[model samples]
Target: MALDPTDVGKIAELARLEISEPELTSYVHSLTQILDLVGQMNAVDTAGISPMAHPSDSPLRLRQDIVTEQDRRQSFQEIAPATESGLYLVPKVIE
Candidate 1:
């Protein structure tokens, strides 16, 4: 399941990445190792095994959502460089 250098070169070209010879060699080696490990999994014979989300059977606990704060809009707007009609102002970009 090793990736071809030609495929790598094409992928680099499509991604606009500048791959040097050393980088290409390093990436190829790393990618080859990953492919070999994945290939090893195909050797396993899991004929009828159920997939699991977690190793344990316990459900995860979650926190209750609560509103705990309020914004001081007038106090915040007082620090703005520009504001009008209860809103911060910015330079108009289009007519």
Candidate 2:
């Protein structure tokens, strides 16, 4: 797909980008090449292929989901400026 200067300018306006004329010309060329590349990639046939998170078959190694810290809520809450019923109290800023 070919992108003209007007199209590029509209895209830049929508993205809130301040682009100069020289940069707009450069971006037009670069964006046109990227779209062409994406079009070519989309033309490939990948029938009967399963989607994968990674190319390799190795499973992800993750740490066990277990609590590793002692619960010191009461000790920490004692130093706070305001706390009530195991929850912190804050001023109502909005009316």
Candidate 3:
């Protein structure tokens, strides 16, 4: 899949991009190389390969889930303008 200037121009137009003439040539070369790499990769056989969640097989280490901070909800609510049932009240702006 080789990308020419015409194809690059159409791609740029479809993407709403304003590419200059010199930039269009550069894009054509770069995009053509990328497509060629993809074509090469697609030519390989991977029939027996299974999908993996990760590249490595090691299990991830996790930290213990516990409370590390003291409760300050009551102190914060005392300083607020309005709070009811442990919730801060705000003025309604929409009908």
Candidate 4:
């Protein structure tokens, strides 16, 4: 997965980026190294290993789900220019 200048140029073009010649060379080198590292990682075997949600084994501490703010939907919608069936309506700009 060694990225060449042409590959970097195509990528930059696709991403709508205007990169200089020096920057293009730097990006090619950096991207090639990243791809090589990914390739090396993919080469390792993890046959029986289970996927982990987090790297650590400790459970995450979470706060209780509670509503702190009062509902102001009705008040907001009352000031809107258009609303219908509890939903804010907007002008149709598309056909």
Give the better candidate number (2 or 4) by TM-score: 2
Give the distance in Å from residue 18's predicted Cα in candidate 1 to where it truly belongs.
7.4
**In model 3, which regions exceed 4 Å deviation?**
45-95
lDDT of 4 by residue, 1-95 (tens): 88889999999999999999999889999999999888887777989998888888788888789888898999989999999988989888799
Candidate 4, poorest ten consecutive residues by summed lDDT: 35-44
User: What is candidate 4's TM-score against the reference?
Assistant: 0.45
What's the lDDT for all of these models?
0.85, 0.94, 0.90, 0.90
> Could you give candidate 3's per-residue lDDT for residues 35-85 as a string of tens digits?
988888777797898868898967998888988889999998999999999
- Tens digits of per-residue lDDT, candidate 2, 1-90, equal 999999999999999998999999999999999999888876778898887878887997899899998999999999999999999999
Stretches of candidate 2 off by over 4 Å are 45-95
| Candidate number with greatest TM-score | 2
Estimate the TM-score for candidate 2. Answer: 0.46
**Which of 2 and 3 is the better model by TM-score?**
2
What's the TM-score of every candidate structure?
Answer: 0.45, 0.46, 0.45, 0.45
Model 4 ranges off by over 4 Å: 44-95
